[model samples]
Target: MTFSIVGRCPETGQLGIAISSSSIAVGARCPWARAGVGVVATQNVTLPALGPQVLDLLEHDQLEPAAAVERALNANGWSEYRQVTTIDAQGRTAFFTGKEALGVHHALAGEQCVAAGNMLASIEVTAAMVHAFENAAGLLADRLLAAMHAATDAGGEAGPVHSAALKIVGDHTWPIADLRVDWADEDPIGQLDTLWQAYRPQMQDYLTRALNPTLAPSYGVPGDE
Candidate 1:
């Protein structure tokens, strides 16, 4: 039982995924992205390796989103048990909802985003998420957060969402933003939003420290000033 959105910032060539689930540790299992490559979300029986396999196709074969998704699915024997979405660096989107999908399933695609869900309260959840992402302002992460909230508002999974995550990749090989609530008894989405707000302002500062400590902002915590 999960809902997710895979998106790209066409202007900045950034890729991201926002997801929440009734399952535990959705962040570690469902979302995957590589800087300057693409993003993929694998759920609905959750074949985690399929995410990297799709990325491999996109990066090595230089395949488009559609081809990458197709080949990745074909390589798996349980295609009908998995649901996946892919978006290449160019913002092209593609998805597959298998025959054995749980509960109700919906997949909606907008400009450079795809929102999908299974065991949802309503099929309209994905549509609302996609619309919110398309219209949300600010950075790609902002749009992804908007999508996450929209999904909750429209009707999330059939049950309460216990874990939520946001994964984003920009110019670095590692994710520039990887925030997660491994488990939350209440309002994991709201918890994730709070984390984003606190993390956003210092994001550049952390990067600066990694790239050039001399230019990094102060730690603001100890005797050193």
Candidate 2:
């Protein structure tokens, strides 16, 4: 019971992913991304290895997103029960929804974007998410958030969405901005969008301080540097 969108920011060249699910702690289980690398969302039955497997394939110069997905699925015997999407550093994207996944499961893949979900209201939910990401402006995370919002508006997970997450990676291959809003009283997607916007300025300030140390704007200088 999940809907997820994974995409690369054409503006910032940053890789990002956003996910929401009817399940508990979806943030910890669904989205996986590495800066300057790629992104993977392993849902459905959920095999944790798919996350690193995409990185391994991409590291070996597996440029085609479809090929990398094939390699990952083949390596994992439980593929029939999994739904996965992988977007490489070059913005090549791929997705697969397993046969045994819940009813109404589907996958959509496109340049720099992939959207997938199971037990959703309709294929329209996942498709809307993809369309929103493809057409939306702003950073990868923002696009992803828009996708999530669209999916929720279309009826998400065929039930309530309890947990949500956003992940953006920087040059260091570590999550420069990782935020998760797990479980909301009602309208979790709206809450997720609000959280992202509210935190966006602080995130921008943090990265600004890190990158533009010479200026040292009002947000204070980067101590990590």
Report the error of model 1 at residue 86, Å.
0.9
Clashes of 2: 0
Candidate 2, clashing residue pairs? none
- Candidate 1 ranges beyond 4 A from true positions: 222-225
The TM-scores of all predictions, comma-separated, are 0.97, 0.88
- Per-residue lDDT, model 1, residue 17, is 97
**Candidate 2 residue-wise lDDT, 1-225, digit = tens:** 888888887667788889888777788877888777788999988887888887778877655777877888898887889999988788888888878998789888866788999998899987898889889888777888889888878877777778888888867656877888788767777777888888887876667667787754563446544
Query: Per-residue error at 188 for model 2, in Å?
Result: 2.0
Give the alpha carbon lDDT tens digit for every residue of 1-225 in model 1. Answer: 999999999898999999999988999999999999999999999989999999999999999988888898898879998999989998889999999999999888889999999999999999899899999999999999999998899978889999999999999998899999999999999999999999999888888888997897777789646
- The weakest ten consecutive residues by lDDT in model 1 span 216-225
